[model samples]
Target chain A: MTRAEAFSEREVAMCTVARMVENGRTYWAAGGGTPLYSILLGKKLYAPEAQYVTEDGVIAPEPMLPYEPMMTMLAARASYRALAWGTMNTAGIYSQLGYMDYGVLNTLQVDRHGNINSTFLGEWGAGGRRMHGPGGADTIAACCWRTILITDQSKRKFIEKVDFISSPGYLDGSEGARERAGLPRNTGPWRVVTPWAMYDYQDRRLRLMARVPWVTVDEILAECEYKPLLAPEIQVLEPPTEEEVQLLRTELDVRGQTTDAAGGWIVWDGEKYIRGGGD
Target chain B: MTTVSEPATIEVLASGTAPYHKIDPDGFREWVRDNKQRALVPKLMTEKEAVQKFVADGDYITYECNYLTRGPNSLLHEIMRQQKKNLWIAGKFTYVDVGMLVGAGCAGKVDTGFFLCTPSVRQALDAGKLEVYEYSNVIMTMRLEAGAQGIPFIPVRSFGGTDGFNHSGAKLITDPYTGQPTVIIPALNPDVAIIHVQQADKFGNARIFGTGISDVPAALASRKVIVSAEEIIDTEEIRSNPGLTKIPYWCVDAVVEAPFAGYPGTVPGYYASDPAVVMEVFASVLRGAVEPYLEKWVFGVNSHQEMLEKNVGVAKLLDMRKRETIRGGLRA
Candidate 1:
């Protein structure tokens, strides 16, 4: 546990799925990404009575549904949502955020990730979108510190290396994505961490910063569907630190959760794990 | 104060226990008719003929969860399949934290465009024909609460200035003081609100004892509304449990009965949330092409009844649910 102990196969998948909700990262998947994206965007994600005010001062629903014309360089509806994933906030906005449609991409653009989130390409109309990471200029920005856990919807929670990756944010590469919008140099390339491996953009090519704890360098190399990278060091990525564990127990565990009849609450009383009994 | 002997002999005459409360179908039907004329004239009604009467090209429609069944096909799926702008979902993220949303939605529609909250619903969308639109529930709520509370804006630190959504929209903006591009997701107004519950009166008064809060905002946001329930209880019964009601009768427009509803679905007071079926649906999508799924969930299942009635479909779905429970490692 001290120096990069091998992660149990179980831990790998847990990390992948759990890390998917970490702070300050824009995630793109196939269909459902609104909740994760909203979390990354720092919204108050609640359910049932999410509130929103209209431009006219009338209260609206959760999952803001903004006009497409007003979207930023990234295709944003600028709508707030409080539901879990793909929820509508009280503000009358529906993020309409979905995972990427690889099929749509293959049919529309030559470069799959190019303008992957763009609505102008085809039948996507205005609701189409893609996310760009904080640029290279923001590299080393505390914002760059992030993790994206990728476990399948599988029951076993298989934690394989990233199946694919063209770049940190969009397929155009962070810099190219920024430039497409006339954005400045992106230092946020440092914002590269995935379940299978960690990536750092050094000179246009991605460098494997580290592998998930316990996973072999070779395992990472083969699992990824992206352009391969050689390890800068034979080192593995740091596993969940004791400090993080403590933080997970004390600070993060009780953020927005509850208990039910089948299971109890997940409460951290500064010492041990409290399983479901609603006590 | 009667005499002791008199009370002993006749107290039984004063016994105040009412025996049974059978539904007055004829009277209830009359009340429903009146409600239909007044509340449901232009508004959508739950009557099969009425619902079928006003079909629209309007992409979004609301449905109650009670009438909705699981297995990737349900009433919501029917509504979703009707939409042309690609289906975007906004609701509770995980059914139970085992994974994500897989109830009535997963088995209902196929090959249709699906959008999800980036992190929460990402799994369901990925395994299907979906596109990801990353938006924050936190920021959106802050804004909605701000709006609901009548504030111009609410300052927050959730996922601030992250890429793809930095200064993203009317809801998200930059704080001049901090220069941090904050997300300002505006409150949403949905096209329709579909909600489910355990009981409702001839009037729209509904009684539920679980988490039905999310439907409120969604219903308030939408232009149209639908309420599905397990039992059309008496108005007195619904009124008796007014405190337990999530959506009041006035807030509701139409009520339809869908018993044993929330199949492969959850309506809180009605049933427990299940994730095993959800994982299997996702796994099934992973196993095959979305085309067959589209055909089966969309073309194959026409209504919630059909989805739940199909033995093969329900069997496959239930198997997945069972397996997911087993894999969850809940046994300790």
Candidate 2:
């Protein structure tokens, strides 16, 4: 027993995913869709290569326009494939999934006048001038994985569900039922990354999609008060692509997304630890 | 670190209730004389040399459990690692692929590399260094289990309906009623299901408790079964504690015990893995990368004992880790 060994091939293998990507990375974008944002941002984070698949199943890195939607929320109604958040390049390149409070913000907001806001990755005060819109370190980081949020005419307020988004991070409690359950009511496509895993809002329920490392698909399922018709994979998760890793790392570098960064804006816990365990 | 006159015999308990029994390798050689079970094709294999010889390159090897402690320098890891398309995973354990993904920057095919297991495991994938290929066999298994349990397509709204749901491999079927598509996970029937158990008897009933995966299905779905247990008690005791029994005796073809079976593993009750040693390896990775660390930790080892002899046990590592925690960081 005195000479026994610690650490097995199996155990080490489990923790390596979190360790693969070192810190110090950043993602820059005007917002296209969630998957694309994730793919590009993931590259900065994990430093891994990527495999880009076309809508037709042809794997490629160069899909040009539709994936870069003018609006935030979108959905591929037919394949059931969605691009509610981040940079998505699927089917016909629709808006992220979103549902609005008033009538429906289904009408894409055309800001082609180019008044779009620009988010920064450095200190809150490091920006050149005064803040124009709602965005900070992670707010921008969220953009790496988040694409659109259907908002009411009110600038500060936003809706929860997109007619469609890429990842289901938030819900559309824009209406009254939310207060009954103590849920945060929103007016636009709101977003959140629960400790457990990735979430996307659809019709009504929050679908538990991909999970972070160390998190169980069930753990997320249990926490999600609302059950969607679908759930994420039961397994922990497949590893990120090489490019995705690189993207996260690069973004972390520029913005400093780590335990030591952002005044610990995002707290690390048992749930979040699942994604970046041993970090 | 000593070599025996013959490879030591091991025992396997079925479920938790079944009593232990001895598995005679010699008798096993004789029992398999006719090779009647050979017709099924050897799926689950032991670390034994004979079993390794039988495994072919293209076989779909499904053994959910990764003998953490045993795998670093394990011949099976070596064998499985060589194959670009060997399906050596299950619904139980899949943390094994993290290192390769990080080191290689590519998680091989889903079936080839460590696929899906738990949500925590999924986190590592999303973080990167764990995902190489993109196939939804994971959703396949969950749905398959439900299907095997006699349910229509189980509901799963994950992978974000993005490309994941759109993935041809991820989608199992299209829903006719809702006019919405339903993801279908085709039943996974692996060609082989290999597991390292605590013990086994001549008849074949076996069991263990770490993470309950679809061993029953893995065995039943596969054509052949290979049982490697740590100990094998008499058949009568097995009948006494039938509650723990997982596999029936008739299904197994070979029985052998390889104690410390899940070596290099942090087996809850059976073994301990040195956290410091892992930290030691990772310290190197922190200083540089995983390749040198793997080269030394993985390739430097000549045998399991030699590897053990080179480091301390997990308890000591835990103590060191605790002390280091108090110290804040490890000082060179």
Candidate 3:
């Protein structure tokens, strides 16, 4: 199959998420996988001046160090501004300093109200599946002007309500819910980007905004546990363009960190797009 | 003012709801008010003395370090060798330090952002021998910041929706001015905080390079701060580079000069991490041979110098240092 034909669900999700990010906005990204790839793709394609800060507060702009040992080593390099703990203690403080404009987070579950869950699934401790703790999701969700959630499309994940709210979205779908919940008036999840479709909050309720070219509104609704409000202008999401695919291959996925269903890393080695390893 | 009831014994809950771990806020307030008048002077000491003098059994201790950088390994080794028991440890993100402590049975409870999935920690948690409390890395820092600022609690926006919010010691309070619900995390105020840095003066004004992580706030939040430095420079050097200083001398109780302190973990401007050794140690931990690994590497060697010479060897150390030169650019 051709490279474009072989575009994986993850790549599509990442590209779609990347397109939503505005250029030159400060972004705080949490969890690896698709969210990290999306931020890197956004920086490479459009958000060149985007200030990217890791959860631990390592701010590095574009022409950034290569991933892997370099990202770890360069994290401690003097050039990376380590905003001392006091200034960047909470996500709210970081947002107040104009550091966090947008956030891309990988949540285990996202509810209709946009509340995210990444902490625990069933019971607390041994009985439950203990996921990674909310690193800065809570803080960022509380203050970032806009937040984007990237997760796989599944009935189990798109639930009526999250098992636990790890990060507040719009609580109870009320007008002043976020303000009442102590979150900044302007801050909340703006987009819920999944492989099958995209969602947004309107009137503090989950609304289907768009769907992948292959999927329909019926399919999207069938996958959600709660009945979702349909957007007035629901559109079909554009597929990954050639340039987007190329950037994802060469710059972002050079290490072949993420893979497709066939267990291959989609790579572009100057001449053409190839699957599996990079040049 | 809400009065927190003092429990007969400190109960460390694995998870569930607010006040997961409790301390009498009134008692803490009285203690802080009394101790605030005490003057602090930096005492130059050995890692052994610093660990022993400040860290007590069942004390809540925080290591001001990140996942794989400036981990205060020397102090951790000393604590391991001494085998201080029932200690509650906290940090932003812990890998080796937490792993070793849990493996050695020194850590009774952990309140941390992130911890490595080591067999020892897993086995302990599964066996119900270890109590674990979770927080996001930034929230951990916020707790420390509140402690440093001498505040009862700080209002935060995050964790309102997570299981951590339900299980945390943080309280949900309405903002009087805005009538908005905000989560308020209580001050941590660890009994002792151990930090490793790039350089420090004899008086303990220390500077760290690379990502400061939560080190500054951790140091400031502790009752006693012990700093281990790769180099002990003159106070004049610290004065010259004032902007780089993360922990001032007033916050420091003791300073120990220990070169190559964060071995295996990199110290930014000084050395690159020895990934091979780190991987080997982790492998050994996963294989349930942590005792042998700790014996040969931690206790069997008398000093960090001996550990470097006998365990890591000069050639491997030299090679790791050489790799840093190529990777040492501000921008790639």
Candidate 4:
């Protein structure tokens, strides 16, 4: 596939997440990679009225640029009064805050039960192959009204069981497990958006709900480590509209930071999408 | 668009066991119980002496700073320079500090919420040279809080849906009061906790601006606390503005006055993260040239003062200072 075709996966993922974002609901975007882009796109296009609670606990209604350097500078420029920690304790926000309505996150591995793991791969502590640990993902998964997980589809990632549970989804595929485990009843994994397909938990098990245009059910099943429960009425995911693509290229990521590979640049010129240009 | 028959039964993955399971909680409880009776006077020391005196081989140490600000970079470099081996480092949202320690082969085990994947650290993990345990940021913070509060454990709502519940050392318990299942993380008491602050007195009363992150809890949870400060003020000044003091002197073991201590990272009110240097280090690490980078920037220089002068240079430092001033002394 060409870079442009490969870029569409990102576009699809971001647009799918953008569509889920509701206006006036406070949403938390945690990771710096794809989820950051999704949240940025959501703010720019669909959820302009949505409030954002930054990792450091600053609440801003205005869209804060997701770039790290820019975010740091913006936080500083806004001052303490504008970007106060407020009543938000780091743990408290994750556990008790009712205002944190939605969270968009990325994880390394997922299972049929929507269990996500970004921690270790082998044994715990001594013999494990360490991956990046759960940052705020555990809290967000356990506490957010709804959580959307985004990842690239691969057999190793789409497994029967995660090596470790970095964040809880549905435990044991049983009803009331989340509530029984002391998670808020209304809070749990809501969607899983991958490069090939989208999944939703039904009957507390991950069910394939949609597939991207070019992907086939056989191909997706072949790529998954376990047999995924297919939805009765699975549908093809609608590709991003021309205007959505245009906004994504021209407004959300004008510099082509997200879409471009290292040393390769793709930008939307006034009339057409172009590659590698000074204009 | 396809439909498939539901599998007759789903197999649940059994939760993995943790290494800490062997550690007797009663022993830790006894240690905490004994420590509460003892009083400590804050000592004044240089960064070198503090690390040398406090940090030991196989010690579980922690430096509580997020990726953004107030990392004890100078102290961590000192630990690297000292070549303290078999050390277990704990952190929440660690970036360069943990990365460098793992890169330098100084860390034996890492207990952290989030760690950046620097090439050397990744290689180490791949090679099974380092042990790692994971927790969510809030879980780790609450664990430290449990230690600070002299409690054996604290119940939390996290890990319910996470694979972390299986692998983490945390226990699943039925809340006695409510009968709801809750995760209980054991108290995490580090051998030493090193933290950077905007200002600290000789008495070790430290003042941290901005978020404060997990520094206070980390300090209180540790057996010994080292305060690395941008400016060492008088005790009178700390007393005058008591609210600014995040970690009290009673919790602090030593105070080390080290300006530009969190270089490459940032100390709020002092400077912003040096992205150019960070990129340079990152590039070197990626290219498998970290040894030369460290040799020149860390070991080649006698001290942080010399390292700053030779590597960061006068111009960049002055520029950073000016930028901090323009930003109203807030880190960007």
Candidate 5:
């Protein structure tokens, strides 16, 4: 089997997201599964100086190995040796003050305008399925210099218009829409990553920047309800190197907690991935 | 994206017109001055007594920190057990505990920023039994801070562009300094705020070792504060480490010495949350078996200790503490 064939969709997504973490930058560490994995992987692989502040108030948290998602916090019996400890106020102030260079957030849907909706699915106030509401995502997206959104791509997710703007992207894709909407100038959705493809907001519109080698641009576009703005040169996303994959599998997520599946646990079944153990 | 001229006098792009839970800052200040007893007496009480005395029916209540970590699950369970009616909640970054409360008909109005769509919560929302006033997690905490500061409102960099702003009691106002638009959220002074901490004294000088998310603000902002501690140490210990005290005795109304108060959650230096137990509860709720789950966990049990002894057992608690000790490297 080919090297690419061995990797799961979740692994690929994480690796792709890890590459976006710029060195010597501060990031709002995500608390969710894949996004959290991506942040840690990025910190470990390349951005060693990329200080992270958690919503739980741990500043510069150096989490221990065999990472248990929630256990990495101050509450975890394992001491993280965090640089400084404060309340959510400290994190909120830091982000609003432009200390955060990058913010990594997960979302359920992303519209053409880059507005994300993690709160509700379907119509609002009409019995929409409520999801995990914007914990710190609102402040992160609004205040961070740039934000990277990680979500699974589907027609329902990559849609024409999000049901609700949990985190404002480019409000209406209009020029200075974000600023007009009272969001800080020169800060908004920077990049969007998925298992299949990568997107960047060029002219405040979702533009296909790169894709995995297996999936065609047309195939990716077919999955999105609204056709994204195509970049002049679509790049083939590099597959996760053997070293990166091994590090992630062994050191970061040994128990396959984050890489198992997006929402549910899964294991590779040689031909196709299948749910394992059961949710 | 192009740079455009700013709107004149800050037009609110998005806002929610939900009635503020308590907006009279002056009244609040007066009440704090007149009603609050600034004494160093033993404020210790049982969870049942604390919840009953402080958490009144139709009162706007809040739990500090995320329900997953450092959340007052035991106190919340007490409220649910008491079956407090029509309570409004400031569910900040909460999911399970809040869902359980709503499921049990303890709370009807929830001003939540981060709550998961469980079957019961969803059913409540769908059936129009629950009223949700959305706000972001940061905004919710900030609102508490505003109340603590005795401010009528607080300004934030974000909120005008999001749906939460529309569903929350947040408004856009002109920043007099920058002559730009700003999102200002109303101050939230909850009737009662319950916090679970790592340690506290008999006088309610609570010290939270890890991530004091919004506990301080919640404690200071609320009319009545209930602090449940994993270990209640001597007042001398608190006096020796005064800086460690996040919530002082003056702010707290009742201090409940409840060990493993954040069961299914974490208490920082004490123990780690059992996610499997939390997941099992979640799964059970999803399966529409909330009644059985509540009966077994909350209603059936008299106290947190009883629940731990009868259902969770000593072995599980020991195992969790061991895991936490290893994870936190408490000994190391």
Candidate 6:
């Protein structure tokens, strides 16, 4: 549990997300990659009582060890000892029934209002690069009580406004806008986990609440295209505990696809951690 | 820090101008009643025969579940191999299946919720060779349910604030009970529904081991169901566990015993997905060698069995089966 351990950006992001999973709460970490690692690691280390579900309707799936990296959310090889096996109907109906407490989503681009887009880059019809349409993020964002967004932090990603609202956030950043748009009241974006920091919605606007140990407030702000509202006291997150790092490396991400030191979003550049890696 | 602009309207206009692929519920119901077979006869056939007989040109078709799970890859390959023209596809949470279909020029229009926009699909879209309609996964699944129930539309609570709502056939309707705005998706009765299952009786009493992701509803909603299974079990075996039968014989029109039907995909207790094979196919697609890849795998082979023997050897398939043995003991 020592803090004097070198951690990659993925470890920081995964741990931050893991810490948010409350015990006994039900969560659906929508996509694979880091979001998958976060919930699985969270269940193992932090919230053992927390129930994790897949979009394919497997509830509380005890994922197999030595994780399979290639497979996404419907990873049969990774899932075993599932409490209940349902279908896409179960996933959607449960969420509508308010059973899904937390929904972690992966986004390609996010805005200051927490509106995220994983659909397209530019204007959707005018020759925008189509980055696969939303699978369940729209449903999760629209139905789940609380939503946590995860993505890498960069000027290109953290935009002033998303090209398309693939999922609902604080629509138009106005109070009661989500209700007006027919989304359930009190169910919207809750927190955002990124490589450099974590954010929460303040008055329906993205407000930076915490930063990783290595990064400064200026550095995070510099990386964002939009100026997000800063928390009154932006706490610096402690470096991941040695055990947390070990669990991620040896158990969840056995292939080093995500939590690897030399691969993924941030890397050790001899003297300091820097961005730009991963295949 | 730059000053933020004034908050914009919550309304999002659809970017694409493609017309929605709408089907008249009454017309579809009458057609299903007039065309579908109600006899309790064995509708056994090969993939080629099933696709040719049931799937026609310009028909709206969808498959059960998705490509990663119990995807009907053999049927899709057969559709491509036959070059079914002007076909419309309904893709819900699909990946390479839609891409391959579009790339092969079999399908021209897609009603999709989550389609992987491959370079080939993108090229087609840019070239005006393809049309895509957007919806959420839940809405699409619910549409199938609506279709199965012979309903015109079903009201839902989501997809209002997003851009997908603007592009889809779904409409924001006033809830009669609460007077609140609600999203209602139309019924989707596909012309043909191709499904792959672990086991099925000769009369198309199918049993899927894993999650039945919209298969039953899709089968019931479609005019025809082409079922491919790992094993053709006896009716007595199906009668032993009547509860496990997801798609009943009445909805199914053809039964094709095709093992490894969901190749490069998993079939729960049968075999684990072959990621290397999927990666290789995707890589070939990215390199613009879709034609060569298809020719080597789908078009070149005589049947799914021959394709398996030629492309994936028995040793590799057995290894996948061994990897999937973990689920055998766990399933009840």
In terms of DockQ, the best-performing candidate is: 5
Higher-lDDT candidate among 1 and 5?
5
i-RMS for every candidate = 15.0, 20.0, 3.3, 3.2, 2.1, 1.7
Q: Could you tell me the TM-score of chain A in candidate 3?
A: 0.81
Against the unseen true structure, what C-alpha lDDT does each candidate score? 0.33, 0.33, 0.70, 0.70, 0.79, 0.80
Ten residues in a row with the worst lDDT in model 2 chain A? A98-107
How many Å off is the CA of B227 in candidate 4? 1.1
> Which model, 2 or 3, shows the larger DockQ?
3
Q: Which residue runs does candidate 5 get wrong by more than 4 Å?
A: A1-5, A69-74, A77-79, A254-257, A262-279, B1-15, B326-332
What does candidate 1's lDDT look like per residue over A1-279, in tens digits?
Answer: 322122222222223233324233222221122222222222232122223222111222232232111111111112222122222231112111211111100001112121212112222213332222211111111112222322211211111221112122333444454333222233233323333455544544456666653346765555444444565574554444343333223332222221011112233334533322311
List ranges where model 1 is wrong by over 4 Å. A1-279, B1-55, B61-73, B80-134, B137-168, B171-183, B208-213, B266-302, B310-332
Candidate 6: pairs in clash: none
DockQ of each: 0.03, 0.03, 0.36, 0.36, 0.59, 0.56
lDDT of 6 at A35: 74
Which residue pairs in candidate 3 have backbone atoms (N, alpha carbon, C) closer than 3 angstroms, thus clashing? A76-B210, A138-B158, A165-B161, A165-B162, A166-B161, A166-B162, A180-B181
Query: What is the C-alpha lDDT profile of model 4 across A116-165, one tens digit per residue?
Result: 87877876555566677878777878887888899767888889988777
User: Clashing residue pairs in candidate 5, if any?
Assistant: A77-B324, A77-B327, A77-B328, A78-B327, A78-B328, A78-B329, A79-B328, B15-B166, B16-B166
Give me the TM-scores for chain A across all models, comma-separated: 0.36, 0.30, 0.81, 0.80, 0.88, 0.91
The complex in candidate 1 yields a DockQ of: 0.03
Better of 1 and 4 by lDDT: 4
Model 4: runs farther than 4 Å from truth? A1-8, A61-83, A86-93, A120-129, A154-156, A179-182, A195-197, A210-279, B1-16, B21-43, B66-68, B117-119, B122-129, B161-163, B286-288, B325-332
Q: Weakest 10 consecutive residues, lDDT, candidate 3 chain A?
A: A70-79
